[model samples]
Target chain A: MQQTNRLRPFFENITFDRDDNELVLNFGPQHPSAHGQLRLMLHLQQEQVVKAHPDIGYLHRGIEKMAENMIYNEFMPTTDRTDYIAASSNNYGFALAVERLIDVKVPRRAKVIRMMLLEINRLISHLFWLATTALDIGAMTVFLYAFREREYLLDLIEDYCGARLTHSAIRIGGVPLDIPDSFLIDLKRFLDNMPQNLKDYEDLIDQNRIWKMRMENVGIIPTQMALSWGCTGPMLRASGVQWDIRKEEPYELYDEVEFDVPYSDKCDNYARYKIYMAEMRESTKILYQTIDMYKECVEKNETALMAHAPQYISAPKLDLMTQNYSLMQHFVLVTQGMRPPVGEVYAATESPKGELGYYINSQGDAYPYRLKMRAPSFWHTGVLTDLLPGSYIPDVVSIIGTTNIVFGEVDR
Target chain B: MRRYSPKDNVQKKPYYTDRYYVAPQVPKLDVESDEEFASDLAAIESKFTVSESYIQLDQLVVYIDIADNLGVLELLRDERAYTQLSELSAIDWLAKDGKFEIFYQLLSMSRRKRIRIKAYIDEAQPVKSVQSLWRSADWSEREMYDMFGIKLINHPFPKRILMPDDWEGFPLRKSYPLQGDEAASWYEVDKIFGKEHRETIGAELRDCAKVDRYDTERFSRLGFEVPKGADISGGEKRKKVQYQEDGGVFLIDRFDEEKTVIIRDKDR
Candidate 1:
């Protein structure tokens, strides 16, 4: 059997009666508006796109291959590089997978803290997406406003963890450090100001004629099409499918916190953008609940961070230095790593983008036998070729931005 | 809290029953029931070789034969309403019978349940492509091919996704080395700097000059003889040679320099 290129029609099948002025456009493995290292080959007839093929993998770093070589705990840091904008969500997803594999139950206080960090990370990611997407659509002022708030969130993250970008704050069983004393104050301040910041963004682009013309009715994907294409997060929500891993599966204390899942039946770029903005507000609500829970736990004199599993989770640095048994456990954990039972488990969490899942197969080894990351961006990127066809050539950038794809996860 | 023994049945029943009664509960929906799943699995038992199926980590996991991949996936998608193919990944089981395990994670939006389907295939065998069933399988299957070398039959464009088009050997294979093989040079680096510059850099960084005379095997392997003038105790002025290669200047230190170290400016 012979296989022809799917993007191009066969020469024998081409009829000369119609105009055959199809121009093949390679839209950026390096183009500025491509968002990241995405190379889309579009077959255009005049201004409309006849066919679109996304050639990804330029940003691939073999993170999965690297996971097989490193110990389970060592691989947590590498997950940060996958979706760097939402690094904590990646870390939390990997940590949850490892904890589930080893059956290490996290403490109540630790669970609350983990939930708080993940929601904060979600806010950071959504802000970053809003900033870049706004900039892509010619709303430069929104970029400035969103980043102004983003810096405050980054400062809060930096106060908790040492790093700003790839904050490997999450440990296997729980979080490494407790929230700082001033962290809540700073978070409250940011949350109080976030609504105003969101309003500032809305003022710039929400009613602008150009923004509406560029977004509405363009790149519209139906609910069925979106689900079949495996689109998650705001992309799926924009298509009127209220499928969120947090609401459906309820991982990491999400059940305790109350927040609404925003959805829109418009199923266009504007609907997706609106869904993202609404989601930020919902995340803020969840954040407020998480903070209150944390304060309550502190008042009750409960352990606020780190699970008490001695074998599965490493002891704290102070405990490792003082206690002899803790020292031995820490030494062994650091050197050889935890050995999970011979089984496989898939754990997914609702990251800012969508369902970020980790599938780990451990053959009773210190390192994962096979670790697979179900990056939501990967599936989102796959739908581009489907969505881009029949749309205008200029609308490609709008579609890409609205889809909110980060190549880190797409090409991981 | 007092621990109640099973022998004290009266107290145990009251305590346990009260605890359950007091807890808040949401009314259960008839959708995604275990009975429905059991009946569905029973319906497809003849077509698919249902080796094992159980709940793990609160998600349904089913292991099916490799040949029935298409039939089972289609049944799940068309009949059972598992519309969303959440993830499709491959696992290398080289140690156990040298087979590759492929996982299909399906999520039913209406049912609000996730089911993971697993199938094992030999290293060289090609699994049936589910691109027609779920569009998400296109890239996932391509990635599986790129990483684990498990081919997807009838895939539209089956090529190396993460690795380069001509890259040799799958990187995620259990047999593949972590640092990669020496035979396959970093072609991207060579593309940036010309082949001649790459060879020059490689040769300058080789450990031939760093070996001691006592390590005769390493010295001979590099085709270098022990020079009588290898002594470098003198405080001689170090010669700094700079070669402009590919828009960046590489500085070479020549005083007791075992291997060449290149330092470039931050802006370069």
Candidate 2:
């Protein structure tokens, strides 16, 4: 083995079998297209890849280990860094996992708000993926267009949660706080104008021949293959699987919200793209419904969302010097984290990528015993080793981006 | 705002009594223990949630003894439904007294269900190699090795994935002291600016050490015994100063904070 290892490169010039050849090439660990710090060892015969092996863990931050040590409520903030893109979704999943462990029902208003932010996050996540994927395939204008709408959504999110990107707006039993009126108005305005922006995206790349050639039939994971690989979200939907966690499990106010689960028979990159666009449109519909629901809830009562909610414990009496009991309650809730039961629960949500599941094990402590993130990116990325083989080198980037695997989620 | 409901959207009816390929329901098997695990595994398979497992989309995960990890992985990838080797990772239970666990997240796109294969390895012998089934396991396994000190018995090219090759020790392990040079900076700047930045490191040290007039009443409200003439800010700085002297300096203090110097006239 040592002799062969030393002579391996020398033997490359003298091929024993010319007709059937294999060349091992390192694709990343630094390549811009592997999505993040992922490395792919591709065994190829000319332009057709014979075998593609993925070498991940470049982004692993040991979040699970960290979660095990932190209190359940203290762990909520950590969820924000998991996906980082659709952070609220991760936070929601984590919070829901904890909530399920404690068997606490989220209030009606909080449920609606959770659904609203999650759907909006889903739209933004898909937009980033779509924009970047298109750019990877050579459509540059789509980035600006996609980001324009994405920025609008981010702004709306920032206004609501006072943070963008990793908005840890979700808490154990409910949302961190209720959405203000102006935030809702801005969201409505954005959703109102999103259809045209989506059309603009379609106009720029949907039917373009080059775009079709690059995405259509590339990285095709058939229905059987997709299911076998545990593919979820758009990737599974692209393969014609009609399963979606939001519809199946009906978490938060998903059952109350009206939207469509878009699937495609095409089972290719084009199908994945189409599925996402359809999903964005469906999200817009959900947003409109959420806005209307928010309005109705506001008009029907002057009470805050948490006004009638059961307190984990009674807040301390109004300050001796000042009668600001509400402030005291808010402070108490913020400082000491929520308590969950000593049990385990798995909560899955239909993130734009796939079935984003959060498995939380609570030992009745403030923190969790285990926090497992079922990242869609990890599932999507896992298929690349199977999909990349028999495809050209350039198609590698196409497959990677189309898979929409976020390294943050993958490595986490 | 308009609510959209697709009239043509065909929703699949969810089955109520289906238990074909659902999650293994083994009476909530003691997740902490590995005794009689195979029997539990059998029970889990039989009590799966769905009746027709083939039609359902589920992720199939099988937890095995660390000794039998490689064998089970090979069987699942070669014999069972697993075709796509998606992700392989490990989790550290430094705080827990039980065995350290490694999770292999597998996807059989053909079956449409995902499963997590778990194996427990003792700290004494933290090595298991499953790189043969999926070559992708090589680096992830190495990463698990690098961070948690979990060895990969026969991994072809096991090495660090995130940290540099020369990194001193695994950063992910809970037992590993959070007292690394990186942690020093993180502890400092994370408080101010509401976000952590390089500058926050210095700000934290200064804030911690900054001398503040001791108010016994305010100190009482904080539920702490008042230290005589000791400012809270001074206390913060003293900690930083001691920390800096202990060869774990953040190195940002030399430039960021002002150094006190006693000026004496040359004539005197």
Off by more than 4 A, model 2: A1-35, A41-46, A302-336, B1-98, B101-173, B179-268
Error of 2 at A387 (Å): 1.5
Give the per-residue lDDT digits (tens) of candidate 2, residues A207-272. Answer: 899888888888888776675556778888889877777776677777887778889988888898
lDDT of 1 at A363: 66
Alpha carbon lDDT of residue A127, candidate 2? 92
lDDT of 1 by residue, A1-412 (tens): 3246988555665553457788899999998878889999999987899899998889987788778767888898899999999899999999988888777778778888888888889999999888888788788888888898888888988999978999999988888788888999999988998888888888889999989988999999999789888888888999998878898888878888899999999999999989999999999999999999998888899873777788677777789889999989887787777767777778888889988989888766667777889999988888987899999987888899888889999888
Docking class of 2: incorrect
Candidate 1 TM-score, C-alpha based: 0.83
The sequence of per-residue lDDT tens digits that candidate 1 reaches over residues B121-192 is 887998999998988888888888888788778999898777788888777877666656553455555666
lDDT (10s digit) by residue, model 2, range B1-268: 8966432211211223234623221124333244333333454445332111111122334555667666666666665556655456565554465457677766544544455666667765756676666545654566567767777677776777556565666665655533334543444355444454554224333223344346542233233445554466544333223224344546643432236555698776
DockQ of each: 0.24, 0.07
Tell me the TM-score for chain B of model 2. 0.48
Error of 2 at A24 (Å): 5.7
Question: What i-RMS does every model get?
Answer: 13.7, 13.0
